[model samples]
Target: MDLNALDDFQLVAAHGGFGRASRASGRSKATLSRRVTELEEALGVRLVERGARSLQLTEAGQQLLARTEGPMYEVADAIAAVREGVATPRGNLRIAAPSLFGQLALGTLVARFRTLYPDVEIEVVADDRRVNLVEEQFDIAIRIDPDPDTALVGRCFARDRLVLAAPPLLAPPSGDLDEVVPVPAVVMPSYREGDIWTLRDRAPRLLPRPVLRLSSLLMVRDAIVAGAGVGLVPQSIIGGQLQRGELVSWGTRGGDVALWVLHTSRRLQSPKVRAFVEFLCDQYPDKAFLASV
Candidate 1:
């Protein structure tokens, strides 16, 4: 039968009856009725069972809808595949990320992603504040903690550790393990929670407090490395610095946190978002960070 007839049948099924389908499909009711009649004639079967108030699909129509749905979806996917191939993930990918990760991690990843998907624009919005993914229209968000919204799908890139560290110059006044230095620290704002500055735990003990406070991790890391004070940071971000002796670890293993790529739940499997999430996972392997910690 003609695809136009199938289209009309699909529209009728989708919209429940000819009149409604006609309005939805932008065809007059008479035209839609004629198309359905022609389709049934061509197929040599009555597709719809007529009732006073509504149309119900006959066995043949139900079978046809079932059979055609998969193929129709395949056809649509094929068209989209070609379009995506031609366009090359070619659209703006709006991303929201914390400032430190944006500066230290995403710049390189975005550079590489741009190199691969040259036509795609990576719009990076670097803020320490959380943004509403749906409301803000962000394609992806690099988040450091659990994404509490069930509306978002979180893909694990890697787990990170918060290293409590000081510059070598400011290690300790007495070089004593028990001595805690009261040092200036820039920290993530109280909006994130000020009660706990997380640390590597003993089998029993937990410590949480920062002597001084500020709003951004980037600011905190800079201040720590500059001998301003000891503060927490992701080891993935400061591995090289630790090796270079720019910072010294306050604990043997570092504190724990996970890094995740958060996207809208429904779009988790979208090609562009999927590609980026996989790229991030490959870039920051868990084993490598685990090895460091």
Candidate 2:
């Protein structure tokens, strides 16, 4: 409520007159008088008695000054706190991420974050299972969908494309996942053990090589690199191995999923969380592991 007028009246009382308040506050006496007059008019009460020489506060002004001084100082403190939080990102940031990303690229991401914000501490949990971010107190979670939980705040930064990868020793002449089905092979972090890896965005009859499922994507990749078999896996995790000649992708017909960076409602506002999310958006704008590494 007309805080400028309240402050002007307070200044007038504190320094004894508009002339003295003008000198103290560096505001012109006319401006100070105008603010005080507006305050009194807004309040529907005369807060001060104007005099030729002596200036005196009325009961209303005295009561307001008594009641509002503490609250105004609190407002100032709150504003200062928000400003400081915006300027600096310093805190413990806990993250939950997909096991494959953790094994393949999270190390580099964490290192980059450390270099950029040395004061922030990073803690990460890598698991295929999606955790309750709020219950676990994680600042962020990474997911590849079709996930059921649609409640979190998130941004999709990259696509997790399925690559039909195999080591050169076991490379199929046909260059098709279905053609390699007779060979024993693998992908981990699977929901079920089956030969039917469905191809979407295309004909339902198309399928990947029947995967001999392992427990983790890393194990599946390692088995493939060691010449075990061809299996469908995310391209983000296998880009390095493909480049290094340890593994080669047959290339898939479909089965690409969007990678999301999800965060809790409360931590979404934090400077550290916002900074990391924005950095992820910039760093990944594509498949991050393939793009960066």
Candidate 3:
């Protein structure tokens, strides 16, 4: 099969259609259309459905797409590898991480990365929603959950403990979590499912049952500091407050969370992506978060 044609197909899918792909790829629409047609003929399958406005991938096309994408990326990586040898890490590294972390935690790291690698461009996407790595063309994603898929590379950078806390005055006495926890509480959107909260080593507990619920951690932290209900927050975000007496621990304690960095193995092979990942692992010092965990 022709790799250029495959590239065209991938570009079209990425850009949402042939016309858009042509504009993005710097190729004329007619030229890109012909190339895709040639690719379809070579593959002996109708890869894209013809329509007046938009293009959709056929079932066979989607299957082929899945199987070919990894190899296509590998091919690009190999070409880039040869063109730009190891010493300099230069390219766009598209990274996506949890909104709060991206906005608050990564500022310093991002600044240092740019200082160290002036040639590299960092595009950070702050999203609370999960991103589809392949379809979204992201080079790196920092996810808080476990990855069941083995195709992508997933490594735990650090472990963060969840703490139940609130302002010093409002916090209940620390000894027994059961009696102390029922004081009003603030929760993140992701925990809104059953309205039931469960603690490690304890049975599921009911909510509204006692406290207020919130969607954003920023808001939760603000509320907790303002003497609002207790909140369950990552120790990484609240450790300083606990030390300064701005916040105090409440409710149950002791659940550790894995901060996983996810990316395709192909992306790991790229020098730019590899450099950034190594920089994150080495410079970010997971120990600070782990100590509190």
Per-residue lDDT of 126 in model 3: 92
List TM-scores for all candidates, in order: 0.60, 0.69, 0.62
lDDT of 2 by residue, 57-86 (tens): 888878988998888778778989889977
Q: What lDDT does candidate 2 reach at residue 267?
A: 46
Q: Show where candidate 3 strays beyond 4 Å.
A: 1-83, 171-181, 189-212, 251-254, 266-268, 286-293
**TM-score of candidate 2 against the unseen true structure:** 0.69
Cα lDDT for residue 136, model 1? Answer: 88
The lDDT-based order of candidates, best leading, equals 2, 3, 1
* Candidate 3, 1-293: lDDT as tens digits: 78888888888877878789987878988887898899989878898897899999999888988998898999999989767766578878899998877766677777788898888888999997888888999988988866587767856777777777768876343333343233466776566444545455543342433355677777787888888777777777777787888997654555677777788895427777777877777654752353322
- Stretches of candidate 1 above 4 Å error? 1-3, 6-88, 169-214, 252-255, 266-268, 287-293
lDDT of each: 0.72, 0.76, 0.75
Maximum-lDDT candidate: 2
RMSD versus native structure for model 1: 11.4
Clashing pairs in 2: none
Residues 1-293, model 1: lDDT tens digits:
78777878888987889878877767898888888899999989999987777999999999999999778778778989887764345667889987777777678888988887777778999987988888889988888776477788867777767676778886433333343434445455662433333234422122334555666666677778887767667676678788899988765344467777898875325667767777777777762452222
